[model samples]
Target: MEVTHAVEFLLLVLLEKLSWSDTKVVLPDANVTCIIPEDCILPCSFKPTSTVVIHWYKQQIPVHSYYYNKDQFGLQNKHFSGRTCLFNSHIPHGNASLLLRRVKVQDRGRYKCYTSTRKHNQEMFVNLEVKGQCAAMVLAPVYLGLATFTASADCFYLFAPAQLWVVERAPIQTVTITMTDEWVTCSSQNVYPVPQISWATNPPSSQHAIENSTIRTTDHKGLFTVESMVRIVGNLTSYTYLCSFKSADKTQVWTASWKNQEDLTYEEGHPVLIPCNAPQMLRNFSLTWTFTSSSEPTLILRYDNRTRHTVNQWEGQAELDQDLVLLGDGSLLLKKPNSQDHSGTYTCTFTAVNTKRIFQTNVNITVAATSVDEQSMQRSWWSTAASAVFVLFTVIVALLQCVKQNAKENRTASHRHNGTGVIEGGLLLYMDLNPSAVRVRPHGAGAHEQESSLVTGPDHCDRTLEPSPEAEQEEEPAEPAEEANEEQRDRFECNEPV
Candidate 1:
């Protein structure tokens, strides 16, 4: 038994030496991008000789401790005890990958993967990046609790926490306070950190909401929908309202308006039809058209009811029909199309006796040219000609049928000749009328004698005519003969032999 154990030990040592010789460790390049609060993985793997030990480090600091042979290092790293783990449980198979759970902005940094073997030690590195979650941006007065917000990216993680500040301009005061999910609401009676705060929301306008004099924080399970209002101090004044939010790291996304914004659609060069009918006559109205390139709109046309005339880059090309007594339908017509007019918003404004309204439309246009080959053109032309030929053939057939019917009647009349009726002004005269007869000549006594003799004269002559079988018939159809006789008599009565 001792000898057998010695042999097995030697074999195991040989295998370990072979594994160390073939060991290869690699890691993906660092500097990756990840949205805030999103989970990410930093891949790592290595091979080892006899005994293997794997460890995960964060920026050279010990993160997850794994002692393959000892099984004790894994219990020491408290922060990574439950959050970090190896990809495969069977370490003998040479899988040294690490998996991270619930990543945060603090997780955005360099990570190290290390492996130790009987022969040597190997290590690899990975870098993580965190990005903001929401695409919707808002800007508002610095009052404590006046707006509730949610972002597009749900993976956001709280980083450094967020703080509200009261910024002010001379003559105007601004105040803001940090809020928690539990106390999302504020009232006029409850004071806040920010008071006497007011600013105009119209960008350069200075209007603000007064903040209550209280500091609140809560560890809520989910996001909070903030409700806020402004108590105007001193007197009621007109001020624009702005709403804004910051990322976990205080990054501004974008801002939208509480008021209705216009979406204009139009095409370049085509006349944009702006039909206007106001309840009140627009005596104080002015019409304007603008061109937007990139994202900024530039004025191109303007009209005022006072001036009764409009000015525009497309001035002469524009036509407007206006009526004063009753609100006339103000229609603007544009002539001559071009690509520069292809995209942008066209707006029209009309001010009536009491109310002023503005309307906007957007236009987009595309143009293209096409080319055809010679073969296709030839095919099309020939196809048309073929149809014409077919129609002509049908017409000719119909005409020929009519001519044939008339000729047949003339032939039947000629066969019932009485006193050798003259063949004049007949369609058969123009045709090879007698298909069976070789010629027509005056039949005298000698001509009849020659025809009879010729039949008996030469062997070259076929029987001159076959005797009609009806000639030997004991009875004949009396009706047809009688009708023929009547027709012959009628003809004789019309023209007697001269």
Candidate 2:
């Protein structure tokens, strides 16, 4: 009887173990993406027939717990002490989600949530992915050989591989008469899921086709470094050349281009029109006109398929025809072109919609001075001469009038000698005669009578004097007496005295 009882006890224990294994917990694996220094939720839930106990663990380390209708985190890990919390309110509804705050790089791993009910036990798992910030550096093109250039950039990511690309440009590369072959290289370093590179040209050429080569290298941190090179063997006659770098998944692409030169000429005072029409019209495009000279490149105008923008210096002097633009003519018109400084090279760049290709046209303009400028200069000289002659004539007239007035004043002052005697030939003479003091005197009169008889002079030295009536009568009587005395004296001289 003892042996039979032992066998039955062993069978009962085996049967209980088999029944527990048959009731497997239905928990699915999940993935969650979270940024560094932010919060995340590790989701887990189970259907419980009664009150349950929930616990969250990070890689077998206890992070948080929930029991007795509240969060019980006494046995939480040190790394997740104040940063872990369980949803206590959802405990009765069989939810055991864990909220992690201020997630750090070390928090990236697997997590598990375990729940225990009165009837069964269950658990769930979650995978966490943390992404940190990254940086990229693009270097300017370096000339490797004659007509050969290389463009490169370095990109790095913290946790995972980064999407990278390379932009190649030839801002001012020209092929001289002595050069034979030309080459351009575009490269990207420390990238994952390697990028694609291609080349294009305006007025596409077959003789100057692109030949590509790539080299893959690895860093100490297991990052990828891809170096791409493109070579052009024969002569290039295209107006523009383009190079593009695209990722394998086609989510990111970078591009650059080079342009050839053209010449244009215009005369001063005439309107200047620059043609910039593309061969094919796209639904959306961008057109920019830039003036390049000794100074910095000035932006003249920009048309972004929607609106037209004119720069400050070119506001009133430059304009675009909207009607012509609608008809696929992207031209710039300058009115009254007068500045010699405007004679320089101009660049017109066009970017199409939904593509990485760029088309650039360079127009070298020369403005010659017109005949109108010469005529204006001559007229200005004539006006200046006329003004100078008029001013000189007015000065001469004023000087003459001043001299005549001074001479007249001096003559009047000399004639009217105000109380001072006149000086003539070094002799002072008193010529102020009294009119009442002038009288005529007889020849043989007494001294007193002679003194009383005064002589009168003429009114002026240049005029003749006339006699008065009294003087005429006295002269007649004197003449008759002279006649009678002469007759008696001739007859008897001594006897007439007795």
TM-score versus the correct structure, for each prediction: 0.26, 0.37
Candidate 1, lDDT over the whole model: 0.45
What tens digits encode model 1's per-residue C-alpha lDDT throughout 369-465? 2213466777889999999999999999999999999999999876765233333432111112333332112223322111111133355345333
The best candidate by lDDT is 2
**Per-residue lDDT of 470 in model 2:** 50
Model 2: residues >4 Å from true position, as ranges? 1-32, 35-192, 207-238, 250-258, 307-313, 352-498
Q: How close is candidate 2 to the true structure, as a TM-score?
A: 0.37
Clashing pairs in model 2? Answer: 439-454, 439-455
Pick out the ten consecutive residues of candidate 1 with the lowest summed lDDT: 165-174
lDDT of 2 by residue, 1-498 (tens): 657645744653354344343355858888997765679988888876567767677776768766666776555667998998867767678778888997765787888877777676676889988754323343454442432222233233322223212222211111111111365555566454456767665666663455666677855333456655556544443445566767655766666555544455667667888766655665576777778778898888777665554343587777888777655577778776654666765666666543322233334444455566787889989999999999999999999999999999998876775434554543243333564333332233221111112234454432222333554455564664554433433332332320
What local distance difference test score does each model get? 0.45, 0.58
In angstroms, how far off is 17's CA in candidate 1? 19
Give the C-alpha miss distance for residue 445 in model 1, angstroms. 99
